[model samples]
Target: MNAQTDHASTVSGRQVARAALWLDLLHRQFPELIEELAPGRTGAPGRSAPPPDAAASARRSAADRADRDAALWNEQHGLRGAGGGSAPLRLHVSDALRDITDGVVELEEAIRDRLGLGRPPRADVPARLRRIAGLLASVADHPVLAEHVLAECRRMSRRCSAALGEAEQLVRVRGRCPWCDSVSLRAFPAWRAVLCVNPGCRCTEADCECRTSPGHRHTWAETSWSQLALDAGVDESELAVLVEAAEPADGSGSVSGSESVGGSGSAA
Candidate 1:
């Protein structure tokens, strides 16, 4: 598969595994919550009876069974209240859902940190959080809440997948520093500048005089593309316009600030 596809698949797999582990932990910690959320009747002991849709029955496969098992493990672990549920039991379930929602937030943060990119503004995050909170506050059973949480986790996973693809593209633009043979060299695609990894080297790809004393440079400074863009003869306003124009309205490829291009939009 292509790099983007591979990255996305890896991300989705990791997220699914993490989600499964967290769900298992949640199930163990609050068995009663699981029981309350079980698919069966209010007082039934097992999974709720399956609907008699022929299409659903026909579509059942090994994957479907696995999903059902996961759902059961995550949601169906508790016993229903005999009459009115105990206050403590209800409180525990509510707390668990809220805790799970918090965990989802943490997961998203961790993904962004790992990807090494600042989290761009997302219009979906607030709404997702609200939905999770609403699910927690409502009288939904554990299974229902677990399903919603899992779905939200997958949505975040998809978002991360997209981010990772963007990162891969940035890495390609930020080519290696030939002076020190360092792949960690920085690039500002907009400015068409690249920096050597050695701090003393201070040599940008656009100016290579520092190569004379590269042996003395040890640490590397983080490259700033905006400043470099100005150094390359583009004003801030022009850079902003270039950035906006280069970005596809369809959201396919992001305009990476560190792209390296030759004089005519060809690869250097």
Candidate 2:
């Protein structure tokens, strides 16, 4: 049992590390995607800049920008408040980052699992895969290449599905509300916060510009591992272990040593 657990831990660690590498590459290579889709970075969705006016100029602060973006997004999506005005956007920009980051990781993992090769530790995995598939696609009417590329595209689609799976998993987790969870569509991990992808969730607590709904219920607890570690006065290594144990992994209450939302990805 001990040996099996150790092996699983090792495999899981490698998988997470490789996924992180891909995310880094994606961040580096296609930063525009990050800028457009990433939380906080994502601007007002599907809305053109308003005509210049004193009021528009007044809403130039980052917090105001985020609020306008969220409001515009909610309006475009036809997601009106249940009882009255706009539903207070509960999820924030960090939540958006978390969703996109987790989605990218899961997509990489899915591709690897489906291809049965995972991502080879050579160059940028997604880029490499895309290049190969593109080259194959360029070869017109070649049966073998066509078959191979088709297979690759099919697997890629599965990656999209896997990316979605993470959101579904996050939605029903013990502490958060289903509406918040459902609204959370993508995530991208940052140094300290998880970005929320849902347009409705586009601000951080510190910069929130949205009105709070009385019915809005946040189920997640407010426990801080770093604060706890500081209070405990543990060494770096000890703090690492304690922090790992406290995070929700694979939706299991117990730590499985596998990285998740609040895991090494966040540290990255």
Highest TM-score against the true fold, candidate: 1
Q: How accurate is candidate 2 locally (lDDT)?
A: 0.36
- The 10 consecutive residues of candidate 1 with the worst lDDT sum are 163-172
State the local distance difference test value for candidate 1: 0.40
Q: Per-residue lDDT tens digits of candidate 2, residues 1-268? A: 9897676555444333333333333333333333433334334788765566876677655555675577668778967545332223323333443554454454445444444655534444355444343332233233333333333333333233333222212211111112233323111111111223333432234434422533332222223333423432323344333322322233222212222332221110
Count of clashes, each model: 12, 25
Error of 1 at 10 (Å): 40
Worst ten in a row by lDDT for model 2: 168-177
TM-score of each: 0.23, 0.22
lDDT of residue 250 for candidate 2: 37
> lDDT of each model, Cα atoms only?
0.40, 0.36
Give candidate 1's TM-score. 0.23
